[model samples]
Target: MRRVRYYQYGGPEVLTVEDVDPPAPQAGQVLLRVEAVGVNFVDTRFRRGPGSGSIFERPLPGRPTGDVVGTITRVGPGGDARLIGRRVAALAEDAYADYAVAEAQWLAPVPENLGAGDASMLAMSAPVALRVLRSAPLRPGDTVLIHAAAGGVGHLAVQLAKLLGAGTVIGTARSARRLDFVRSVGADVAIDYSEPDWPDRVRAAAPGGVDVVLDAVGGPVLQASLDLLAPFGRAVVYGAATGKLEHVPVVSLFALRSVTGFNLTAWRRANPDEARREMDELTDLFAAGRLRATVHAGLPLTEAATAHQLIESRSHTGRVLLLPGGLGPGAA
Candidate 1:
């Protein structure tokens, strides 16, 4: 089996694929014949560090961590044997590998109608999207702003916002095409965040102020989003992709504006049953036509470096996938 690994942290070039014997799953884990891997920006951050700050404490010889959609070929002790041959999606152990192990209880069954790429979102992105939106006080008719709104979770957040009764969905991305993709996915307005006066544009669109913000790109962007919130509005911070999570300012909190931080693992641990319900709801939404997963590109496993490059550069509009089991559904 081929797996992506990095001995030293640096640029995309550091990631190298090596052929190795596949390992068996440990107790409570299931071995999967990975069909596709979702390439995420966080993998790039982990690849560039001996310690990727407070969020990721990755060590040497690190591999990408991501969502994987595959078939359960074998089950380890404590795992259900009946799951063998079941198509499912889970956050994989050493996710970039052609074969990986996943926690059996944490995994979700992939609906027959859903493709591999969309199923991958069910593992991580879609649930996060749904949770972050719900983290804040999101009411019907609220105006919502989704930063990086054309990326994996952002794209899904845009649609879910509308479905959850957001009156106006404002999306922010770096490129024209990304803005268009956000619009295509039901955003009421799309703005280019790369512009210096982008917040002004957002202000123009909302007129009063944004009611809710779903932010992953922290730092100045997060601060700006917080600054633009209307009275009684809320902002949910889920990630710090900019490498800096900002501190809330006193002024931003005035006028009843509030900020909340969310971590997927934390949320799952804190609200196990509700977390499971959220996952099921997202999966069901995708299974129906209510949700759509926009895939930017599906490349071969060998091009893991290129996938990282796309994510790091913010050039892709949605989830960039890797085909580990060759070209299948949602893979080119």
Candidate 2:
């Protein structure tokens, strides 16, 4: 089996592909012949260096972990034998490999009609976007503002807001291309957040002030977002991908507003049923052709480093996938 590993924290160059023995599944786990890997912005953050959101207490060897769609080849003790040949999507650690292990209990059976890349998007990004929007408790006819609206979660959130009944959807991106893409995805308005007067522009579009803010870009953008909220409005910060220090500006108690965050793991643990419901909703939307994940590019498994580069560059319009090509039951 081949996998990507980095013993030290650094840039994309640290990721190396090597052939090694495939890992066996543990109790309640199933081994998958991984078909595709989702490259998340947070995974790049984990690779760059230590951060407050890191999964580890100290720097350690890193193996990219993200959404993986694959076929079940084997199962460990206590796992269901009948699922061995079923294709599924899962969030797995140590997953930038040809084969990865995922928990059988939570496996999402991928429909035969769903491609690996889309299944990978459904595995994580779509659900996270849904969860982020709900964090602020979006209401019908609410004026919503979405930051980084052309990125993976961002793009999905834009379309979802409309479906969820938001009256006016405002999206922001750094480049004109991205802003255009945001508008195409259902944003009623799109602004260039990179401009100095971006916030002012946002105010011009919605002078009454934004009703909900879904932000992933951190640093200055987070602070600015707080200032743009209407009285009683809410801002949900799910990630800070700026690669810079992130902090919030002070808000007066009399402001009648709030800032919240959505940590996927914690949320799932607290509201398992709701989490499942969100995924089901996304699945239905995709099936009905009302929602779809825009695939930016697909690279081979050995070129995992390049995939990470594409994500870190922030140039891609949608999800970047790594295809673990030609190592599976279907191989000739």
Segments in model 1 whose C-alpha atoms lie over 4 Å from true places: 50-56, 330-332
The CA lDDT at 101 in model 2 is 94
**What C-alpha lDDT values do all the predictions have?**
0.88, 0.84
TM-score computed on alpha carbons, candidate 2: 0.93
Top model by lDDT, which number? 1
The whole-model C-alpha lDDT of candidate 1 against the native structure comes to 0.88
**Number of backbone collisions per candidate, in order?**
0, 0
Q: What clash count does candidate 1 reach? A: 0
lDDT value, residue 107 of candidate 1: 91
| Model 2 C-alpha lDDT per residue in residues 229-271, reported as the tens digit of each score | 9999899988777755455555432488888988888888899
